[model samples]
Target chain A: MSYDFMSVQQRYIEQIEAALEGAIGSEEETLYGVVQEAMRYSTLGGGKRLRGMLCLELCRLGCGEYERAVPFAAAIEMIHAYSLIHDDLPCMDNDELRRGKPSCHVRFGEANALLAGDALLTRAFEYALRECDYAAMGYERGVRGALTLAQCAGLDGMIGGQAIDLRFENTRQMTPEVLGTLHALKTGALIRAACLMGGIAGGMDEGQLELCEKYAAQIGLAFQIMDDILDVTATSEELGKPVGSDRSSGKTTYVVLYGVEESRKMAQECVQEAKKCLHDLHIEEPFLYDVAEMVISRTH
Target chain B: MSYDFMSVQQRYIEQIEAALEGAIGSEEETLYGVVQEAMRYSTLGGGKRLRGMLCLELCRLGCGEYERAVPFAAAIEMIHAYSLIHDDLPCMDNDELRRGKPSCHVRFGEANALLAGDALLTRAFEYALRECDYAAMGYERGVRGALTLAQCAGLDGMIGGQAIDLRFENTRQMTPEVLGTLHALKTGALIRAACLMGGIAGGMDEGQLELCEKYAAQIGLAFQIMDDILDVTATSEELGKPVGSDRSSGKTTYVVLYGVEESRKMAQECVQEAKKCLHDLHIEEPFLYDVAEMVISRTH
Candidate 1:
């Protein structure tokens, strides 16, 4: 049987794309125009758009309307976009290429790129907050959902992880625990938040929310490890960015610390854990299950 | 005669300082320790603490409860701190000194500084969300407040202003209108947010909220103009940071575009407008009015 997972993910990506486009519109005032353009530049410059799709899918699975989740899906993607813009800055990663295009700074200049990233990050919350006016969903649930998004995006979550990653760069000894912490905040925080926010938006009870979090945590790490593996194996053409860029930057990765085989095994184990969590939930969504498997198995 | 306004503003600042200390307790682990330390590095570094004090004052004036505004006050300060950290980055403002100490990047390295700034910005929301839950402020209001904060900080507000400022640097002759737009976003947005959020938290009526917004807008610009004037005149020893840094950077200022006398005259007019708004509110407290005047008259 052909695994229809890619098709399902593609559909989800399209939905998120439409939602993002709708959310970013503005009139012709100078300030608003600049903001709208900056937002478009960072977000429209594409990637997998996975954060948004996962959020929408989980919201649907949790019994929330896909429409209700769309704002949040766009918001999370904005956050992801902002992080990429800033990460590519000269003071940071200084990458010239992203998604096969000149980086934001290279295209728009450093000042605009910095401002663009900052704008997108701030706009993420603005989008998430629009959910507050969704009369169909209870206001309390919307507030909780936005709050969850903020927490994940903030210090204790994604930003914190990024700090650790920056601090540990170029160090010869990289501990497993440190690496885990870094990935947890850097990559895992936003993913877990995406899952949790969906559940919260869908009005999941504590138990269902817990299950989603567990699954999300596993897949999030698996996703990062796969990214690490891809850095070593994938070509620039396939990856749409430079391969071996991570190693060249002197940044540590799972493959560097654990070797390729062990790292792959670790990623596989994470997928298995994610699957077990889904199985325990007894939900019959084959799409989410397949997506979990694909998190580790994908080439890029 | 003693200025009761000065005393009252001082009292509010003291209360916010105490509450902020309580809120930022010890870190849980090394990871959290780093996060917490970075937060304190910025938050604890001294400015006038105007934003936090304004938040508490607004809460008290609107809600008649200073205690309830503590988290919001802290959250606003966190946002302010994060912005300063980012603004001082090498690629941004490139300031080596802030508040008489080495900048965050200078002390922590560029990567950690960037992460610290990100964390503080993110944590501001986390702290605010916690308040939404703990204060039992209905979810609708909490979401609205959070959304408002995001809008103020986002592209349409703070980041947008910063973008224009950078774009105009050493390249274009700026008009007063352009300078106003830049200052509104760069400085006015958060100040206005501080006042508005305080009112929101307190559940103020629409009229009162509008008054606070008006007052905040005037004062925010007034504050920036005052800084511009000080940059032209204040010595480094008195200013705590390098004096005339804005001039050195070849950035436009109120004093540069308009003559110093004209900028000073405009600042006074703005202060008068702000006071008029407060007067229309018929508030019992005279100290807030005094604080506004003091803000305009401060030497450093």
Candidate 2:
């Protein structure tokens, strides 16, 4: 059964926020009180919650109970949040704004921010593996899902992408190939994991999971291109954060290489390919389609 | 077939070092070459592979095949290495020497060191979960072992202990209770996890796992007390690293609270209790018994 796109997305976002509040020890201050505060501030402060929603929606479309995926959903968001925190470190991107507020390192000390990222990454595995405790999704799903999550976060994926991105800054290595490889690991890998994990948790067959991954890759790449486009075209207010950040940082982005209009066209093409994957898989989830659209159309 | 303590220890250490070399992508550098190099440098440059040995030795003693525990043994060492990397960060302990060489953050920059720690931690789970690939270990053990690893590494354990240690620096919060809690999380939990995970991998019953935990805790605490004693009693030449670091850092170490003599006596008492647990549980692992002795008597 298809869902009403906006309502389902909104509902999943709310559930994810509440669950994250509970998962992050928000009710009671942990003994790691300052790090806990830092984690909660970075995580619960506010974002689109797109990763959580993507996971829950895919699990639902895979004919699984969405409640069982909630923990994993929140876990992926924590992983995403940790990456953002580390990316904003003074020695890294050195951005002072995230989601319209001072970044974690800007608010907390750099050390606490670093520890909070590590703590958040550690907690993601804890939460992902806890899926084994729930009856609706048993050990097999939990183990596989958690492993998938770990794989995407490791050197082969997000972290690897980040290293390459850092090494290429203000360098002459800004080819289209390098940029594509960079985003594939930096942003696309985790997004792919979010979808793959949901399908795995839902007990989808191998072919179905592959299809989910294909769709995820397309959308993930589209999402990054759209981000690049918005960096050049959208106002800082419209973006809810600073615009022209990519150019100012001396980093190569899709818009920098292909121009804003071409970058916008490329994003739309990716969204189209992503929709084709859903059609081929015969996925009946309206939320998934709308989610793909949101990536490229967010600025509008 | 009980063997000489030294020989058995030497053999296992060799196997662990070789296995870790394989596990940390020794075949080729990862895409994140610098971080990979930092991880390899910190991990392979060993002081003692104590954690890996505990896991493998206990597994062997549990009547399981030693080979089946190799991956996990390598994984725990990676976890230990990650902790050291983060602990040596300029923002943390600010130590420059590890294993008589420059620490990870000193050798590599702070940002790469932080990412290396994250990558190592991520690889630990990746390796631990690969136990699913072996027909001997099976998914049940692999999944359970990994869950236990995550539990020990998360907020309730190592990270939590680290935060407390950081906060209590140069502060008046040094109670016996606080010191007890700090060390319990800082060092004890992973040691406990090492033994308990060995038990879990060997298919030990729940009661047996609980007994393993008890033995682990006593020894783990005693190990920390001995470390404190060594910081005061040992020399830079003997310790192979700087001594008196704990006091210089304004930490509330066991020796600080109870004096060197009392801390030594307390360490001996804890070691004795640790041996008593093995007697009570009828664990016939002589290496484990010797391991407890080595914790308190390593000044030579």
Candidate 3:
């Protein structure tokens, strides 16, 4: 069945944008407002909102109201945004541009950017826990969802992945296993979290949640491989940031390990695997397939 | 009424240290274990475990076992350690020494330090939530305590205070009120969280929690005033950090607004008020008073 993937994506994007705008407080005249301003600038600047979309969609597919997932959707996006801000810091990637604009540090100064990243991360938890606890969402599910969020964003997850990335930079020890570990933690972890938390929010059972994790793992890996390909193929303008940075920095991406053609085939295989996982569960949402397809075809 | 304050303090410190040591995992041989190393380096290398002591003492005083508060006590100290790591970053305070040893960024690189701080903060929530949900702690109290942890460490709290401090640095517009607000958010918020969360862990009702908050607020203020005074009166060796940093940076502080003599008197008054708060609550915890006294008299 042909699905209106573009329209659905657009709708989800709009919902996510509105939720994100509302999630962050308005800029105040107070001295501490600068961090808030920096937070808004980065979080609301621009992106695919892919993480938020996955969360909302997964929640809807799990027979839960998508609206119930909006807070978490906004949260994952905020987390993604904060990671980007920190990733672009002078001490990290040192990139001055992100999403076609000056990075947080470039615009707000380094200290404010650092604090903004810190604030955005802390605020994400607050927004998440707002819908949790003794609220409509049961305590067990809320705690589980929160644990997923914290773990994915914590030492054994995204931060750990960054550490690996930094350790192996410009080194010849970047093996397939190391690269896989890096991608899984740095990027895949959050993606899986978005999926798992969405399922948890929808009150899915352990089996269903396991299926969600499997599907997310496949797509997340595919997404990173495609990202590696796009870094080599897409223009700087198209990507909204500097392209070929991985190659310039001698970062061992999928495209570096396997050539462009081989990487494309690998990503396609992962997407196929992802779709099969969804199909095994008889998910009514054909849009999940479309999202997997987009991961392979996405240019930026 | 006399308490063996020294022995009790020593015992509590030992408990906190052991808890903190156990809370953080050992360094792994994997690529990402370096972040864990940095996390341990900063958290284990500590000064006074005052926050943890308050949490445990309050829990015990509220008719709950102090052991129940150990997880939270360790969590607060982790949060505190992370803040110190970030504060001593080159872009922030630029301090090379923390607790008379090299700061995280100095020992680890700036990027690693940043990631280590992020990891610690995220890990704090993970550890706190470990005892929540369907656990012995009722979901209501668990959620309340977690919310307290998030809020106090968040934008309107410690991070917000840091923003204000950065904004007003070397500026002449820092009034007594602004300084008060900064101190309340920066240092007082976490101290207050320690007290309130400790009370929450003990299942204290709203009224009892209010008393804990009042006592904490007074002590937190007194603590900062003493800190300001110590910055001038104590030697760097005694403080474990550079003295006269405020004056050198031209940063406005309690001592900046009110001279050393006045600040000392103000701190003493706050301690008196704090004691009254406990007395009115009919608390039997004489160690609480001792802890309050240490805040004003501490050299570091």
Candidate 4:
């Protein structure tokens, strides 16, 4: 690799942060203005911009301008942040701390936090429709990219997965198939969409897009497996919030089924498959390669 | 005026219901499948399909096929249903009934209701992107229409108004201007978007679009005013829920500020202005005119 992966990741993160700020702000002071404040608090605070970065890199690798993907990248990040806020709600995960600070509901109150999540999710489409142009990619490509986003975020995707996750919370009878489907819908769907949308923006043909999807699917599962491994091995300080949360919640995870050693091996295998998929795409950019590696190897 | 208004409304309602069903429904049922069931219950049940009818009618008036507007129409209804579901949450209005049936959270639980709302909201865009083609409406028009939905649904629109509504729940110090902004954001924004999207679908010029917006703005406010009037004058049986809810909840409504007489006057004036705007748009169908009149005259 000619360029440093850390530097590249930092650049995308900064771009995503700036874009997110520009997309949401209040010009007038009103009681309603607190909505924007809650939105900003959850979104602007530091976290891994993995979703947005994947989108940007995939768009570039797909032959589209990285700039054209910035709005979309930021939008994806907004969706992620909203999911976190809602996930931490008193009724959901009941989490109080996020990024080592009070969660959105903790600071903004429950109602405002909920609205903030709703606002973020809605604004994602708003930005995609108004700012991100298919003309920069292709008209059809733009439409498809946005559609992919909505689909991945909808019932058959993230929401569906979340429902299953919440339902099977205390049941240790989670079959491997259900666990696989659960993670695929909950997290894999959106991650797959990020890469696929980048491919669409790059004007990738059906074959190429399928390859992108294949790569994203592997990395997405691998990413979750690594997360499970980290929960067992990593310190609370390193993991940002409490470690062993999955265990406490009794949430079925890769580590829960396959011991630590096997989970690590599985994540590495998935990353290897992801790299091979990237290689089949016939582009020699090492950026995505490094990203897939980071997904498996990262401690947090 | 030759066609029966009831029949026209029935036709559109049926279409919206069918489209909504097709847009949602999981082929494979899982333990988590109740999300779709909850979505169907709140959405497919009986109610005025007013928002959707507006989109379809405006599309027809603007010179587009009403069928082309069906998917978008259904999407708007999903947005409305989602707003209602979230609005009735324990943290929000805590209502237990809607359209003579148990509120979604009542039947499905708070967590599932929340996910159902989120799913419906997400699926609205999915349907728009996947099924509603601008080829019948022009690509830019399609994009603009979807964008309108997002903006109306986002922080600057419905979510923004809802946040303020929740914040000022017990505070009776709402000024008229603040009240206006609140209603405009809360309900007027979505109504306005419905009309405008119909116009874009119909290929309306800028002047025609502006006329639609003007007509919508007045009718939107009138619609809310009539809602306030019903709250005070109508019975619980007529409303299919608790009447005088605004008073009991300490919600500072238009009727609270202006009194029954003045609020009635304001609503009538809005209807008259809306009819004028419709007239100025050179629409002779009398459908929109009757709809505007219906807005003020409906008892429940």
In model 3, which runs have C-alpha deviations exceeding 4 angstroms?
A: A1-3, A133-135
| Predicted candidate 4 versus true structure: per-residue lDDT over A9-128, tens digit per residue | 999989988898888864458667888999999999598888888888888877756887887788788888888898898878889989888999999898899899999999998887
Error of 3 at B150 (Å): 0.8
> Cα miss at B240, model 1 (Å)?
1.3
lDDT of 3 by residue, A1-300 (tens): 467888989989999888888778888787799899999999984898888888889888876577777888888898899999999999999999998999999999999999999888888887787755335567777877877898898988899999999999888579999999999999999999999988888878788899899998999999999999999999999999999999999899998888999999999999989998898768876788989998888888
TM-score of 4: 0.97
**Stretches of candidate 2 above 4 Å error?**
A1-3, A27-30, A133-138, B27-30, B132-134
iRMSD in angstroms, per model: 2.2, 1.4, 0.7, 1.0
For candidate 4, the docking band is high
The DockQ figures for the candidates are 0.60, 0.67, 0.85, 0.83
Model 3 residue A68 lDDT score? 73
DockQ of 2: 0.67
Clashing pairs in 2: none
Compared with the true structure, what per-residue lDDT tens digits does model 1 show for residues A1-300?
666777877777887777677666653567446546756766873778777777877788877466678788888998898898888887778888888888888887776777777777777778877744367568777767777887888767787777677667677466888899889888998999888877777778899899989998998999999999999999898877899988987878999899899999999999889988888877787977877877877776
How close is every model to the real structure, measured as TM-score? 0.94, 0.96, 0.97, 0.97
Model 1 residue B124 distance off true place after TM-score fit, in angstroms: 1.1
Kindly report the fnat of each predicted structure, to 2 decimals: 0.72, 0.65, 0.77, 0.86
B236-260 in candidate 3: lDDT tens per residue?
9998889998899998878878798
What C-alpha lDDT, on a 0 to 100 scale, does residue B214 get in candidate 4?
A: 92
**Candidate 1 at residue A162, lDDT?**
70
Q: State in Å the error of residue A70, model 4.
A: 1.3
TM-scores (chain A) of the candidates: 0.94, 0.95, 0.96, 0.96
